[model samples]
Target: MSTLTAVNPLTTLERRALQSISTSDGNMLIVAADQRNSMKAVIKDAPNGSDAITREELIEVKADLVRHLANHGPAILLDPEVAVPYVVDEGVIARDTALVVGLDASGAETVDGLKYTRFVPGVTPRTVRDLGGGVAKMLYYTRPDRQGTDSRIFAEMRDLIAECNAEGVLLIVELLTYQLEGESDEDYAAAFAGLVADGAALAVRAGAKILKLQYPGSAEASAAVTEAAQGVPWAVLSAGVDHETFIGQVATAVANGASGAMAGRSLWKDSLSYDATLREELLTGRALPRLRELADAVDGRRG
Candidate 1:
């Protein structure tokens, strides 16, 4: 077991989720399709550029992706609103695949010039557990140089941690960065590495057991982020970067101590333009292969 697994120790629920998600080598290949508005945007802007889709089409597309992706032994992150319930009801998710549910309703736009994520008003840890989710996920906006925790964000995370603990489920906290108003792109760029490292450290300090963090820019930087984590198991998020770029990022992260990856867009974005059959083919052909390659990369580092 890893130091975090030993020190914190997994509850039965947490262990079940972890076991379902992790390969025998204890590395993971997590397919994150839990996007909300971002997913809609992909569909809207698909190749033809003007295709109209019904609610059913959106739900089906997500559901199919979940089903197909799960077959490759990857844990899937799905939105509770449409994807999770549908797949669970239809028995589409494989029994051995871990199911993680998104607990936030998020958009691509910033709120008051700051980017952040909040719990969807009605969703709770218990509700997600009841919906067959083994893990509940939430994303938080953070910056590298920030002093103290944003009181509201801290309070929200604390409550969420407590709830998930009580409900016997795992929590995966994702930390992200957005440029604040008046900050130059150059300034944010300079701080990007610090943001990835320090932001992850902050989340770990906030009691996050499983962290989803950005790649911290390079292998050397990733090592710094890992050290700051102090042995907490963390995975890198793809952040909508292109596939080849993300593949390199994942390899670098794992080599530098990241446990695995929790990525979305890079895996399936290209397939959005195709029909259902072609989409599934693309998922199996393109996405699954990439996930397996990443999984192998993670396991290689483990060895």
Candidate 2:
């Protein structure tokens, strides 16, 4: 939806936003507690009487989440600007981490006055630079090619990403890579490559700042190390029902090219009946002793 004639790299604020991403400092994890996963944390006290969490309860939990994350040092991403206050009510998110939109990175409509946003439509780097678009970011989507088109959807997205670059917007491509299982590991890896190649092409042609690449489904073996953060920042699942299932996903993210992960359900769901501190521990990977150990090590480095 951009109307720029020439393309360019992201602007200053855009770059700052992109560089602000961290999986641990509490800036980019999906933390809203009203949805299905309740961001993995149960909502024992929703004042609104609806599934959507209330500000008061969020205020209480957010502080605890931040403290837990500070000790662990990771950023979490939540949706709806209304929740922005929870992250920065006291200027915490503004001071400690980066936040990305946690909306439906797959749609552009609204429900119950809630805009189910997937991408930031009608915006570009020029808009951010010339217009009042400000330091806005975008979320890209992936999955089985919809609308009967080919995987060329990536290329089409590449062009749009170019426009977003010129408009000073950050385009983060989400990873709905494959149908999980029934495919070979090599095929899955190639799919990830294809996704990255699309992002790299867009960056080279124009200059988008971030690549929200998700990992391959068939092989959840790459996301936990330097390999995961290879091309750009990527998002990983909060967790799967199984233990090895989630760890494998994190491992793949690290192996491919991901600096951090944004997780929800796995952390919160299991903590439904637990106390806030214990819930915090679970979300920070304490439930899984190995994960908690890893978090402590990461925190040690930052300290």
Candidate 3:
């Protein structure tokens, strides 16, 4: 647990929602299946997969993940387009697992080399609550190194936060930084940590109570993010790194004051397949073990 004090008190419902999605010890281990375009790319690249990925196929993949992994975590993050409602209605998710619905659209629009976030139409905090989701997640792309780049998005986020507060839904604001066109990879890597910390600070200033952020380069940077959060309970996102790498990142982040982890591809990417039997085997043998390792990392039980 972080020693930093919370700046704002959580509302009754917000506190309940947070508790519902977290372990008894107050750490969160959230499995993320909210991906859309990236998931389609995976499906398309599968050995037996066709060029055209169907909605049913996507739902099946998500269902398999939920059936196999939901029981191992306190919450699962799903998107409104495919996973939401379907997973809940089918009862594939574990009864004890809480649902978090992603409000962002499938992909972002790149304008002048910067990515802009878009929300799924009609997917708001109230609608998420109506859909039986205990929390709402909104992913926003930011360029903290570039001044004034995220002013509009921050304004929109403030409105969303107010709406969530009014509806009594806890919102987890997820921040992702992107490299601009023509920027050198080395420069981007060097600035990555500060960008994440600055982005977290910006979100906190915009009234974010909870956050999901990318790995901030190193342990010291992770501590910087914790400081920027001001006790808002930030979690580290996997960013599609390999499972082993993600585990190390999670371990470092948690040790440096991250609340826990929110991961998707790092846990289940290789387990995806068209063959049901093979998929099950891979999920059980590969993904489940990875999930356990991640959970252990979150709880500080890993050797």
Candidate 4:
């Protein structure tokens, strides 16, 4: 498809109407698009009836996927910069224009640990750069506990962000807290908020603008979001599970003073039927009504 068609999508834009929502500084609502974060996919022989996928073919798939997502309406595009450029180099699919979001996180570490040098080897040195002169941002995901700050990992993040500089790259962060699967929603939200605040503070001091952190669950979630975002220019809340859940969550985030949101599975998990309907709503300005309703529901309910 032509770049014009991909971006303008003459048909309609209910999904693209995202900017009309709420914003801070320059709020951005994005959708995370990645089937796998495996830096290098371990190729394997496929069973009969399966088509072989060459590295070039995989690059094409990645590019096309990006194009498809770009049409969905996102001010910021989240993905590992290193992997994205690989596809661009192949010319299979070149979404040369996008706001880059870089995330560096690990499994068993604390907030401070991420600030140091110890990190999952594969996710080190999170960096962001300009793609087609648009905007670029980077964020280092880390745990909050001082013990969690691994020397190697944090050092990598510190160096990478500092080197990226301004004019081309914007770096911020998101911190995950609690065992996502085991903690209570409230506790989980508290942990997430505390960690987000810690990371947000660090990122801003170094020139980062947005903090893409966990979704605070309820009022506490709102408070955490508010607290973490204190003095920060902007923030993007993590995506939730479904449209309803995401809307509610986003509403809370906005109330907590978030500028926009970054959603993934929650936005694309629906059938094509839903996409068409949602798209139309955005183009016609009809979704604003619904957004208001959502905002009402989300108030004081961030967890």
Top candidate (lDDT): 3
lDDT of 4 at 46: 26
lDDT of 1: 0.76
Per-residue alpha-carbon lDDT of model 4 for 96-176, expressed as tens digits?
Answer: 334444443322344532332232234323333322223333434455444233444355555655544423344444544
Weakest lDDT window of 10 consecutive positions for candidate 1: 1-10
lDDT of each candidate versus the true structure: 0.76, 0.43, 0.85, 0.43
Model 2 lDDT per residue over 146-262, tens place: 311334444555565666555545655443333333557876566664544443343333334444444445333433212323334445544344434554555555444444444
Clashes of 2: 52
Residue 81 in candidate 1 has what lDDT? 75
Candidate 3 per-residue C-alpha lDDT over 1-303 given as tens digits, one digit per residue, 9 for 90 to 100: 444667756787887888877766788888999987687676545565544667888888888888887667889999888887988888888889999999999778987777888889988889998888879999999886664425776787788999999988899999999888999999998888999999998888889999999999789999999998888999999999999999999899888889989989999888877777777888899999988888889887763
Against the hidden reference, what TM-scores do the models get? 0.90, 0.54, 0.94, 0.57
User: Any runs in candidate 2 off by more than 4 Å, and if so which?
Assistant: 1-16, 23-37, 44-55, 103-141, 144-169, 177-209, 218-235, 239-244, 256-260, 272-303
The prediction achieving the highest TM-score against the true structure is 3
Residue 91's lDDT in candidate 4: 48
Cα RMSD for candidate 2?
8.6
Model 2 lDDT on a 0 to 1 scale: 0.43
